[model samples]
Target: MRVLHLAPYPPARDGIGAYARVLAAALADRGHETAVVAARPHPSSPPEVLGALGDPGLPEKIARFRPDLVHVQFAVPAFGLRVPAVLRLLRELDAPVVATLHEITRDTALLRAPGRLLYRRLASRCAALIVHTRDARAAAGSAELIPHFCAPPPPSTTTSDALRARFSLGSAPVVLAFGFIHVDKGLDVLADALRHVDDAMLVVAGAVRARDPLFKPMELRDRRHEREVRAALTRHGLAHRVVFTGHVPEAEVAAWFATAAVAVLPYRKAAQSGVAHLALASRTPLVATAVGGLPDLFSASGSATEPREAGEPSRGLLAPPGDAAELAKAIRTVLDGGGHPLQGLAPGPEEVAARTEALYERVLAGAV
Candidate 1:
């Protein structure tokens, strides 16, 4: 089926952007004609730039392509341009629409009250909705929960051993906290937790942008969180061990993943994480907090290497949110677990893409 993906995509560089980019690639691989319409959030651009252009000739583009469905990978606050306007246009075109909820918050996590109100107006109008995990599904209210698809980074063509060596890491045990650095990401908590692991070096990758929701707040606590992350690292003498490689390019990230012993998600608030999916696709062991849709990602059957069973604990270890000591303990478990990497927890990209295709077909059949 011809499918149009109306969601934020890179080089805009955000979680949902990355998700939409990769998902579009997978849909194309599944023999569906997929095209993406993304927003360009310039530093100086007005906040309502996307909304100003209503359909912005998007209907013509959709009609020209003749898509069977228009799938929106929603990110609530970030992908504002795509969701509400696209959903509104689909109504005019009388075409089926699918809204993928990348975030599901019962209470406000990031977006301000006004932003939340705007999001709700758009969310309630979709033909159907998709979320990444069961937790997200439960939060979706009337939307469908679809498993996210993850494809392996095209076979490692580069060697991160050189990169690792360059940092004097020289085979030091590495724990990666990948993706955008935001207040919700709990980087300070991670920095505090790592103070206990003397031999381990933390590789904090991903870029920081002003549009990042974390900095949107003017509260002293939020500002102080950013300051504390930098200050705490220095105060604790962790400046050398904690490396923030601000937003490494996509092409270069796979090598870092390959070099790491484990990847951590120290999110204070989350809906679902594409980083966790990427780590799983890379077949790396994971350590994450037990919030949002994270616990649904893995299962622990006492078999550390395999994915968790339906009712089992997660494949990865989980700790309390914002507790540095608990986060540190979870990290220790992953490191001491005799190298049992988390694998086979979820379907591969092909399987996930197939499932998505079936969902698209159902939506076209008026299942939504």
Candidate 2:
């Protein structure tokens, strides 16, 4: 099968980009010929509202690739106007299109009204939609939940001792918050939660691209968020407990996960998270917000718990969104082993690669 996998690819290392790159590689390994139509981020590429308008030569690039099936890894915010235009081109080509919706927010999320409208338009045109979690399915009109996969664990280059030494970290428990930095990811709340944790260090390993003028940075929202988070840490006198490693390479990330005692995805919203899935693949226990696709993703682990009988509380410590106090309590409980450990998160890259290959085959067969 010839497949053209589209989304934010390299040079823009966001989660959706990572997902597209990895998924395309996996599909290629499964015997399908895959070509990727990746767009560069603004300032780095061009500042056109639609990402591809900056790239005048993309259509010729797609025509040359001539894929049998086109899979679009669509994120409302990142693709900008390029997303809809890509869909329109695919429609003209009459290729079977599969759009994987990476997020779903009614309002006040990253994309705002225009983003949602664009996403809705793109989704409506696709032949099939792929969702990462059940929570995503609920948010998307009618999408299939094809569980997201992770990269294969890298060979152990450095032991825990070596990792600790490299980062100047002590023997204190390390809780990893890995992946791209964003306002909705609940980092500020996590920062506040750190005050309640004793002898535990939060290693935030991700890039801070949320509000940069180059790539749709939420100046007001993210700036205010960063300020409040710093203020909270200072108020609690816990400034020294956090290490912010802004966007390290992939090789370095594996070492952080291997050394950390656990991982966290305390998101304010839930569509689906590749971070949570990656943590599970890394064999690291996780404590995440009980919203969106997280509940379904971790439901297999017995880790997802509803604190209240329906409306009383969330199944997984269900804290109110943006509530620093509740988030702090949840992190403390998880570190202390009071929360669920999720012992069954050991899926390997081989398994993920196989499943992804099967999905590509299914899409190709149906489309052709």
What would the per-residue lDDT of candidate 2 be over residues 1-368, giving only the tens digit for each residue? Answer: 78777777765666787777666666667777777666554455322113342467767766776767777877755565455567666666656788877776523255567666776777766777877666667767687666676454455665778878877788999988887666778988788777677779888887656533444545456656666766777788876787777776766666777788778787887676777766666656677777676765444555544431233211223455677677778777766666654434434445655765566567667741
- Tell me which residue pairs clash in candidate 1: 206-247, 207-247, 298-314, 298-315, 299-308, 299-314, 299-315, 300-313, 300-314
* Cα lDDT, model 2, residue 153: 48
Each prediction's TM-score against the native? 0.84, 0.80
The numbered model that scores best in TM-score is: 1
Badly placed stretches (over 4 Å) of model 1 are 41-57, 80-91, 106-108, 112-119, 212-215, 218-224, 300-315, 338-343
Give each model's whole-structure lDDT: 0.70, 0.66
TM-score of 2: 0.80
lDDT tens per residue, model 1, 62-117 = 56777678777666455443444555665665457777777767234445685567
Top lDDT prediction, candidate number: 1
**Global fold similarity of model 1 (TM-score):** 0.84
